[model samples]
Target: MALFLLICLVLTARLWSQDDPWDVASLRAIEDSATYAQQVGRADQIGFSLGQQPFIANVLIWDQEGTLLYPTSDGFTPIRYELTALRIKEIETSRASAERPFWAPFDHRATKLLTCLHEANICLIYRRAELEQELGLESDALAKVTEPDRTALLAVMSLAVVITGAALLWGLRPARPAPAAFELIADQFIARRGDLTVELTARDVAILDVLMKRDGAVVTKDDLYNVGWGRDFMPNSRALDQHMINLRQKLDPDKSRPHLIHTVRGIGYRLEV
Candidate 1:
């Protein structure tokens, strides 16, 4: 069961990892270039292309004066601006002075974009005018798409737990009861007297064979222990007590007053016909 749970957890982690689609450094680089393009008032003139074929999308550029420009989608448009050089210098200064790496602040943004790509299969476009509206819709769609089937997975795990528990229970079942030693010997004696009948477990028959061979004498705890449990000496005396109890129950007409096998206090038991 533990092994099964471990396997399930490993599979789940692999599935989640496979589903994760995003490269942080790549996204950060794209964002940085986009920021530079926007600050230089050339966002409309500049276009970002992705993939092998270089598919382009129209982007709205903003100048330092907050002036918006819209570029034609036909081709690249050159925008003349004196602040472009100053913007580059400012970016260099910002990079040098920044306490953390340039990509650190945008980690969450990159992760969100990656998740969107994995679930919604949508391209993230940072349009100046429609940014808010597109972002809201994209985030909502991504949330809906990425939501895993937790309820079904939990049910399956619960079922597995129940099955494992049941299997362990079945495997650990106790041994079945065996006939008493005295009853087995008595049955053998009766069988020799023109009545062939003996119904006893192998363990009970072995004990009976040992006692009958001794000819009704008292069998010490050690003697019974060796023959019954195959031990050199008495190990657990309670085992002998239980076996004797089973023997009395099977042989004695009134179990409350055992007649066939008699117990000697603090010593052992004797079998008498």
Candidate 2:
């Protein structure tokens, strides 16, 4: 899951980088051109220039005459000569407007080429060099920008998760004690009377502790099977029963009515608290 999230973040960054060139400013210019064309009820040409040396020009020609000018290998060729003349006039008008030096909405040089004859033909041109320059500036800006190391962050996050998981496992581990006294061991027996001192192995202590937890409650054979041999189907459980019997003999003086360990008729056994 962590790796998946990391990959997703990296992919998102890559996509954002790819789209960084056509940023908000570029889209705004296109929108403004569309709005102007709609209001004037005539075809409009919008041009944008980019970069320090401004080499490229991008032109958009909108014609209401329903004429389609196909672009050739070299450049666009309009079928209607009148539409071409109108585009040239528009570009010239834009250039004559001295009130604004840089093109409004975009830095590229913009001018009205010509006036439309039937208010149907509009021609626009854009220099490709300007777009390249803009892209170059955007690339440079991206390069100069600093970002956190994704690999390093992922490594740190993975380590944190592993550490947290380990801590949780440790906290959930069963409590145990080091070898102490015989009575301390006997105290682990399910049924306790104040007198006996019992010697038991580590396995024996574990079994006694499990039984003690459910004192006076019937403990099934399957429960003993799991606790003693981790539910190993291959391991015989006779030894476990023998250990219980031995523990009973040690704790109960009268073995007939075993005070420590008692057998249930059809079930398993119980520890009398």
Where model 1 places Cα greater than 4 Å from the true spot, the runs are 1-198, 232-234, 253-258
Residue-level lDDT of model 1, residues 145-214, one tens digit each, is 1223454433322111122322332343333333233334444443111122435566666666676664
Worst 10 residues of 2 by lDDT: 108-117
Q: Give the TM-score of candidate 1.
A: 0.27
Stretches of candidate 2 above 4 Å error?
Answer: 1-192, 233-237, 253-258
Candidate 1: residue 75 Cα off by (Å): 99
Give one digit per residue, the lDDT tens place, for model 2 in 10-99. 444343333333232222233333333443322222111111112222333334444333222233232111224443333434433322
Residue 61 error for model 1, in Å?
A: 99
| lDDT on C-alpha atoms for all candidate structures | 0.36, 0.37
